[model samples]
Target: MSIGQSVSKHRFACVTAVCAIAAACGSFALGVGRSIWFDEGYTLIVESQPFARMMDLLKVDVHPPLYYLLLRMWISVFGSDVMALRAMS
Candidate 1:
């Protein structure tokens, strides 16, 4: 009820709001701007094939088929949305 108390409450509310906004923005930026590196690129390349082809390729390829198969299914469900792709990562 006092002026000083009101001012302190207002300042605290502003600081809390600003901090929440900043944390959200930072998470968004980190998720959106992150780049896929070599392993991710290779996963995409392998998973982009049809299942039969992917299986055949898996025979000769060195990496596990499970991850690539999961990626393929994920892409099938979500298409190429960057957020979905990043979530898979």
Candidate 2:
């Protein structure tokens, strides 16, 4: 292969690698920031409540009961780490 062709191939490879790395970085950043929201904090609090009593608290909350119910189920499937919990949200 000519030198020019080799150079072009190297440039393409570099661009592809950079794009992949950038996408991975962006996903990780979003994952890290996922736990930094008010609703997440509220979810954490509600999830800590006794299973039998959570329904009463949900009755008075601002959002729909469906979200709280889904969150409760999610927490059961995945243990309640803030990051893990937020990832499911």
Candidate 3:
């Protein structure tokens, strides 16, 4: 491409990368030290159960199962530490 177009493309990429980093840093900072509240505690409880049990609980509960399913997978990969769980969000 032309010089102007090339510069514009590079600038766009730089801006996008910077914004992504800023957002990630902000999210981690906000979430890292925070304690889990009642709803989050329920999520952790469900996540700790077996997959089938979690599914059963979801059936009676109003929330969807997909998040729990993904959280299960995340826990499998990352372990159930608070930091890991928070980072998954």
Candidate 4:
């Protein structure tokens, strides 16, 4: 790419990153005191399981397992706390 294009792409990436970070922080802050919704709780429980077990359980569920698997990675990195869980969205 040309230098101009490269600079534009870099700027776009930076702005996008900032916006994403701000949004996640805002959501986590707003949800700070509230209990996790039932669906969130269910998601957490599922994502917290061992991989094989998680796969087995997901076989019977309608939702895709990829979501839970990615969420499992997120939980492993950040945490399983209410705020951390909220930030995933």
Computed on alpha carbons, the lDDT of every model, listed in order, comes to 0.79, 0.78, 0.86, 0.86
Cα lDDT, model 2, residue 74: 85
Candidate with better TM-score, 2 vs 4: 4
Off by over 4 Å in 4: 1-22
Instruction: Please list the residue runs of candidate 1 whose C-alpha ends up more than 4 Å from where it truly belongs after superposition.
Output: 1-28
TM-score of 2: 0.56
Task: Give lDDT: candidate 4, residue 22.
Answer: 96
Q: Order of candidates by lDDT, top first?
A: 4, 3, 1, 2
| Tens-digit per-residue lDDT, 1-89, candidate 2 | 99999999999999999999997777667877454578777788887888767777877887777877787788788877776675566
Ranking by TM-score: 3, 4, 2, 1
Please give the lDDT score at residue 71 for candidate 3.
90
**TM-score, structure 3 vs. true:** 0.88
User: Against the true structure, what is every candidate's RMSD?
Assistant: 7.3, 6.9, 1.4, 3.5
Identify the candidate with maximal TM-score: 3
lDDT of 4 by residue, 1-89 (tens): 89999999999999999999998778767898898899898898877778888898899999988888788889889989988787776
Identify the superior model by lDDT, candidate 1 or candidate 3: 3
Model 2 clash pairs are none
